[model samples]
Target: MLIVGLTGGIGTGKSTVSKVLRDAGFPVVDADVVAREVVEPGTHTLEKIKLTFGPDIIKNGALDRHKLGDIVFSNNTELARLNAIMQPVINSAMVDKIAFWRAQKVPVLIIDVPLLFERGYENNDYIDKVVVVTTSPQVQLERVKARDNLDETKAQNRINSQMPLADKIARADYLLDNNGDISFLEEQIKNLMTELKGIAPKYGTK
Candidate 1:
């Protein structure tokens, strides 16, 4: 299987690309989805998080994601602490998913991780390529504000919390520019899928 890492900043339309892949029958293991699963109520991960971030972050026997986001998004130290607690479990889950897909002999596997480079997944031996989706800063900021219902400053803070889009683009083996309409973005993804199809067959032979 060809292991491809798909990543982008907060509002660069990475989710749209992942959806496109999914609709086209590609299996995408989204880190954000796995992250939520690992921290579900009664899980050890959630217990550790409650202890670390305090019990207030939990409500109705579940982790209050908004409360936790507010605490960490404005503070880098708190964010790092949260990541330290979450990354290991999330990574393990993602690895298990990948193993399952590989065993099924899927031609291509896309891991939609927001922080692929930040967490060093790009350097993993199994990752065959990195695709970074990006758009202009203005477009990204607007999208973030509208999608998250945040003011400009808060939206910018969310964007600032991640590795910059430029840095991610610099490291990309494939780049999808999402500055235009959905049709344009879809076209780019279609081209990328075509290329990946050609490369997938020979991915592990070497």
Candidate 2:
């Protein structure tokens, strides 16, 4: 099966495109969802996180993600430490999901990973292509503030935490520009689905 890696910076509506692709009948595995799943309460990963970051990060039951985020987002070394614990677990689970989709005879599988490029998922053997969603940085900041209700400084901090959109664009095999209206974005996805279907059948058929 064809594995397509979908990535974009924060507030670029990557999830919106993912939803559209899912609605179009593609099995989309969201890495962020998988990341959270791996760290669910009582999981080995969660235990490792508590051991590494401290027990205080866990709330009454679940991991206090905001607390963990506050620590990691400010320190690159801390973020790397957390990634070291979670990345492999998430990747393995994601690969299993991909295999499950392929067994069901899905033609094209979409892996919507926010850090597809950062984690080298795009270069992995499974991913056949990479699609990077993009828009103006100003639009991104505004959307993020509006969506998450963050002030300018906090929004910028979140945006700066990821690899820049321009760098991702340079690596994209396909680009979905979400600058215009929702209808325009939808149109791009429809066209992309048509194109991908043409190529995807080859893997599923034989």
List TM-score per model, in order. Answer: 0.98, 0.95
Model 1, range 59-85, lDDT digits (tens) per residue? Answer: 999999989988899999999999999
lDDT of 2: 0.91
Per-residue CA lDDT of model 2 for 1-206, tens digit only, reads: 88899999999999999999998898899999999999888899999999999989999979998888778877788989999999999989998998888888878899999988889887788898899999999999999899988889878887888899999999998999999999999999999999899998676653
Candidate 1, number of clashes: 0
Best by lDDT: 1
TM-score, cand. 2 vs. native: 0.95
Clashes of each: 0, 0
* Clashing residue pairs in candidate 1 (N, C-alpha, C atoms within 3 angstroms): none
